[model samples]
Target: MASSSAGIVTGLVAAAFVTIGVLAHQASVTAPADLGPAHATVSPAPGAVKAPRDRRHPDALPAGSGTGERVVYSVDDDRVWLVGPGNKVRHTFAVTPGSVDPAPGAYTVTSRSSRITGSDGVLVEHVVRFTSAGGVAVGFSAAVDDAAAKPDPDRPTGGIRESRADGDAMWEFATIGRPVVVVR
Candidate 1:
């Protein structure tokens, strides 16, 4: 009877290990090629309908940011805009982008952390993560100490740094499943 019980326990443990392995494999297959295994499960969707943008101004919210409440990040401008209802601009600010930029498309906010150590080893707060790029988790965060400095070019990171005030606004505005649009 003792030997039979031991065999049953061993079988359960082996089954659990096999299940874990299968799950890990599935996850790897679904992740984007550039994002690696740590990427959020939600892949970036097609680009939003673009509105005509004014090439002259870098500050006025770029055209084609999409209507309704959304967070828009411009890879070229290094700017962020928190848009509200009726396509009104609630807040606009500059940001220090990370080494890797997500492609120009639409993604939903996948997760958030109030305070945590960033991939660059800096203490950060109000981390609003939307997508992954270049084998790293891409998100917006403010340095806990308010530094909001530029990231090291040598490191492959996706942390878009923002001011503390801006981080606060982003934390409040961008919740899970919120639309995040990446423009030029």
Candidate 2:
């Protein structure tokens, strides 16, 4: 009876390990290539009407942004807005800011990465690097598991996180050298 119980326990442990391995494998499958953010924008299905745009935040713009097209980021609100020609808002979304905030100024999107291990050791996607502060690159990314948990206060965090869907929109909207306006 003792030997049989031990065998059962061993089998259960093995099964748990196998289950963990399978989950890990699935999680490791990276997001699709960064064909710029347009790849994720899907058309409405048959017989389905498109949803109306959200004009709730009409005055969401900060005071310092340019009147021309640009990406506007509000450090106080931790929100980003992609402005189009004539100062039209193309897309807007909230973001998980880092421990450090970039000063209120104009910056350009310097680089982008489809996938990368964030400074916090998280597997991130849709990395859009905008500026460097205190030797750390500040950018936006989504976790592999699509988690948007707040950053750890103890760690030196520089990755401004967003949902996978939002990150995709940002990745598509902001390209290399795209203007970024930071406001308080």
Candidate 3:
């Protein structure tokens, strides 16, 4: 009888332990309540902000200048376009100013010359000079050379001229009467 009583006591203790363990497990398994709205906010790093998307300038010439009067001869990362009228790309090229650098302010084309010398004594003309939106003067010159031989039979033979050096940085097209577009 005593042994049976002892066995009963042992079983009760075991059952109590088991119950305690189950209760503990249940408590541990419960989901945590959602905290109220967070008070502290995190922000992105200084350089993390993405650059603003570039919008197409209204005065900027179209990629193809769709008039059949102009053609897109070359494009650089869609930033600068070399366009010419009458399918003669050799004469005119339109550049979107400040596309490479920020423009100071509104500006206009005061005057243009075919050749100008750099401070380094290198002759680099064939540039369009503009007075900045802030009255500061700036120029954009094409760093291309004319083709060795005239490729287009339609264009005038004498006006299209270029330097003979391979990779010549100076290029000029015959713009005697053609309308050129300049954007700020």
Candidate 4:
């Protein structure tokens, strides 16, 4: 009788473990809430995706301009796109444009400065210069204070302003002679 009781207890413990394992496996593969059969999202790891609404800029270029790894700037929309070698848009973000805009054509990164006072009298970093507009060096930068206000018209500047993090990405991506394509 004791042997039978022991056997029964062992069987129950095994069954409990099997049930727990199955439940954990199911949880790992469970699908997320669904709006409908046509639109259901899986529970992905954190930071795996950008919000659906923000996937692409509303006014973004349908296709990138330059070939190979390069930066594409849209003068009309005040947006910047970093294109990879395969012509994939690695990153896209908005930038505060300066008064002077670059011509709609191809240019190459000419110079870079880690930190400098912008022509607008604002300190900026990650300066990636490609061209000059009316003697003012045109480049991308992030304000030292990390402000995102529109360019100060009174400042009369052509310093394309971006967020500090975006500037960092631009700095790393656009070295000297990297192609910069400006489009209308």
Candidate 5:
């Protein structure tokens, strides 16, 4: 009888471990709530309309923006997400894109200027440049006068304008060599 009792105890312990393992696996495979059905849809055909943003969580970091510390800029949404370790979104904000948009791809911060005259002739601060399009240097900046208006369409410009506070955050987060992911 004691032997039978020991066997039953061992069986229960084994079952518990199996159950725990299954649960952990499920959790690891499951997408984060904000990601929504994204990982599976990362590589849609070229020129395919990008997935619609989650209306419920518009500020959620876009899916397929890659993992780890990086900046994600969505051209369609005209928004930026500062992603940190563990794929968490540290901050997100709307931006005003210029006439040229960077092609959807990964890039690293190539340079930054604390204060400079933007291509559009706006006195800007915290200029964080990552890529260029059509000879225009693409970057994020805030106008010294706090202007965040749309850029003039006639001129080719690449400044993705942000608010002063947002520019400060970008300046601090996007150091040189930090990954910047552009998505449609």
Candidate 6:
């Protein structure tokens, strides 16, 4: 009887191991492919409407008091917006929320850069970096609560290198050198 019991236990342990191995194999077999590289050619479904225009602007006050703030920006649905005081809009151009995927939500501007000219005369423009606060939703049910610039430990630079880091994920955006004005 003792030998029989030991054999049963051994059989059960072996079965458990086999089951785990099968599950692992199945998981590996069913794993999805990385589709990021091939996503460029994919087009949106027919009749699917794009997201509404971003009307948000920076928080800067209008040039003249009581004149209703005028926001400068270029309209690009692909980018995010920072709504200024009196509903003035400022286009950050390239900076977008880290959580933006298939569908993105509103993001608030966390930092801004002053106008800077590049040595190439290309006019390296100012950038407005933003992070996801609450109430902003996006695709894949992901959201960002905070973001900051990536600090280079090797070289301590003065200007903040804009970056978005939500937990382990991070993203960066380049600023376009154009401004448009909108009155609220």
Please list the C-alpha lDDT of all candidates, in the order they appear.
Answer: 0.81, 0.72, 0.34, 0.74, 0.82, 0.30
TM-score between model 5 and native: 0.73
TM-score, cand. 4 vs. native: 0.66
Which residue window of length 10 is worst by lDDT in model 5? 35-44
Taking all chains together, each candidate's TM-score versus the true structure is 0.71, 0.66, 0.28, 0.66, 0.73, 0.21
Residue 68's lDDT in candidate 6: 23
Q: State candidate 3's TM-score.
A: 0.28
Candidate 4's clash total is 0
lDDT of 2 by residue, 5-65 (tens): 9999999999999999999998786522311111111111235222222368544665436
Runs in model 1 with CA error above 4 Å? 1-52, 55-57
Better of 2 and 5 by lDDT: 5
Backbone steric clashes in candidate 2, count: 1
Task: Report the C-alpha lDDT of model 6 over 106-138, residue by residue, as the tens digit.
Answer: 122344444443221222224343322232221
Q: How would you encode candidate 5's per-residue C-alpha lDDT over 48-158 as one tens digit per residue?
A: 456457789888877667778989988889999999989888999999988888777677899999999988899999999987777778899999999766689899888
Off by over 4 Å in 2: 1-59
Query: Candidate 1 vs candidate 3: which has greater TM-score?
Result: 1
Clash counts for the predictions, in order: 1, 1, 5, 0, 0, 12
Top model by lDDT, which number?
A: 5
Candidate ranking (lDDT, best to worst): 5, 1, 4, 2, 3, 6
lDDT of 5 at 29: 77
Candidate 6 stretches with Cα past 4 Å from truth are 1-49, 52-103, 115-123, 132-184
lDDT of 1 by residue, 34-108 (tens): 212232322233562333467777578876566778898887778899999988889999999888777776778
